[model samples]
Target: MGMQPMEWTENALIKRSTDFGKLCALHERDPEAASAKLETMMQTVRTMLEHVGVADVNNVEQASIITEILTKKFRAMHDREPETTEETNLIRSFAQIHARVQQAHAALQRQNGDKDTSNKSPNAPHDNAVPPAA
Candidate 1:
């Protein structure tokens, strides 16, 4: 047997992120679009998950965790939506932005992985990153 992979125990969603400004600004400015985006993302993820099993449950669960945090942030804004917290503005905004980033990241991964060749050395430089001078 070989060394297994390690699992993240914390919020892996935004842990590595240091930037999300433009989308977040748009989220704050045009909340309606953000709401629609959130709903669409949730539906997309939910639909994709319909065919997955326990082994693939991590994605949905991660989204849920992010939703909880976003809900709390929404509450912190003090504009509590009594009738429909589920449809709150901030929560929707956060979900919308997060979903967009996640989708883009996945697409980038697919694009990058498409170029990975078995003949390449494991220690070789990544195609996306600039290589150092010789």
Candidate 2:
């Protein structure tokens, strides 16, 4: 039987939230904070998933799921307007990260789909193929 999929338990969510907060704290003060933080955030997520046994950290579907979860958590937790410059910076960085993640996933999906079509057998029947004569 195929292995069971990893469950996103409460504990895992809490741990990820804490990690994200810490990462934001560390990057919010940097000069190129937004870009650097976004890059680090992506890498951190990839590392987190790799450690948790996700077969492919760069898998488009997995990345999309993680991005969606994180985006929801972030919106819920930071619903209020930013009260400080640091908070504003963090939010901006998060927005950029979210947008980039979405774009990357779309691109990867398209690339994979193209490869799938290209790899199809030459003799395989396609939707547009003409019917054979009796």
**TM-score of each candidate structure, all chains considered together:** 0.33, 0.42
Tens-digit per-residue lDDT, 16-123, candidate 2 = 666665554554466466456666766666544444342332553454456566656555666777787866765675566555554454444344554666555443
C-alpha RMSD values across all candidates: 15.5, 11.4
| Candidate 1 lDDT over residue span 9-81, tens digit each | 4654453121122333455689777657656645544443332223433554555454455555445444555
Provide the clash count, candidate 1: 0
In model 2, which regions exceed 4 Å deviation? 1-14, 21-43, 46-58, 113-134
Error of 2 at 123 (Å): 34
Model 2: pairs clashing at backbone N, Cα or C within 3 Å: none
Model 2 deviation from the true structure expressed as Cα RMSD, one decimal place: 11.4
